[model samples]
Target: MKTLYIVRHAKSSWKYSGIEDIDRPLKKRGIKDAHLMSKFLSKEIARPDVFISSSANRALHTGIIFCENLEYPLANLQINRQLYSFSDGYLVKTVYALDDAFNSAIIFSHDHGINTFVNKFGNTPIAHVSTCGIIGIKFQEKHWKNIKKGKTFMVEFPKNHK
Candidate 1:
């Protein structure tokens, strides 16, 4: 079985003027939410086999917080520029390309890619994936490329926990 943990990046700062979207950092609430969510997940599940994040500042920072809370080495986190995309195409391709050796992967990215992806690949219907939201889906397929619609095992968001 293959398990996928998808995390939408924390809330970003709109206060920074003249900065590119990819360079936008997380706001204070975002940081707090990340910490809260990461710690919550750490207790809810085991450490995933791999952790991947968008190169965007907010996404990467969220991934880092999760890694720290999960006790995964910071140096092992994989940063992919492709994950910075807002579309589901890249998200699909990334999952399909995942190495078969790893049974689980946690991805930190943006939406509507996350929303589209979870609805397409997960049995549960999620209208929107909010900032610092996480959803875990399990697939019966043996290979990453063969994965299809599977079970939604977990769904957590900042508001629900707060």
Candidate 2:
């Protein structure tokens, strides 16, 4: 089986208005929530075989925190530039291109795209995935390319921890 872990990037700070959207960093709350969610995931699920994330500042930071909490090496995380935009189709295409050697993978990205992707593939319904939110979908197929619809088995958000 192949599993896809969808992680929405934590809340980013608008304090740096002068900076571009891609450069926005996570706020204090975002940092704390990222750690919390990561801890929650560590206890609730198995570690992902690979980690992929958008190169944007907030997304990358969130991925790094989760990696640290999961005891996964930061050097192993893969970055994709297209993930910075709201492109769910492209995101899925990237997942399809993943090496079949990895059974499970986590993707850290921004919303609209992430939110839409989950609702599309997930069997459960969700209005929106909050900051630091995580949704896991399990596919019956062995290869990433063969994965189409999957059963949504995991849904986690900041409030669940609080």
TM-scores of the candidates are: 0.99, 0.97
All models, RMSD in angstroms: 0.6, 0.8
1-162, model 2: which lDDT tens digit per residue? 999999999999999768988999999999999999999999988899999999999999999999999999999999999888786987788789999999999999988898888888879988999999999999999889988789999998999898
lDDT of 1: 0.96
lDDT of each: 0.96, 0.92
Candidate 2 displacement at residue 129 in angstroms: 0.6
* Candidate 1: Cα lDDT at 26: 99
The window of 10 residues in a row where model 1 has the poorest summed lDDT is 83-92
Once model 1 is optimally superposed onto the true structure by TM-score, how far is the C-alpha of residue 58 displaced, in angstroms? 0.3
lDDT (Cα, tens digit) per residue for candidate 1, span 1-162: 999999999999999999999999999999999999999999999999999999999999999999999999999999999999989989999999999999999999998999999999999899999999999999999999999899999989999998
Tell me, by lDDT, which candidate is best. Answer: 1
What is the RMSD, in Å, between candidate 2 and the native fold over all Cα? 0.8
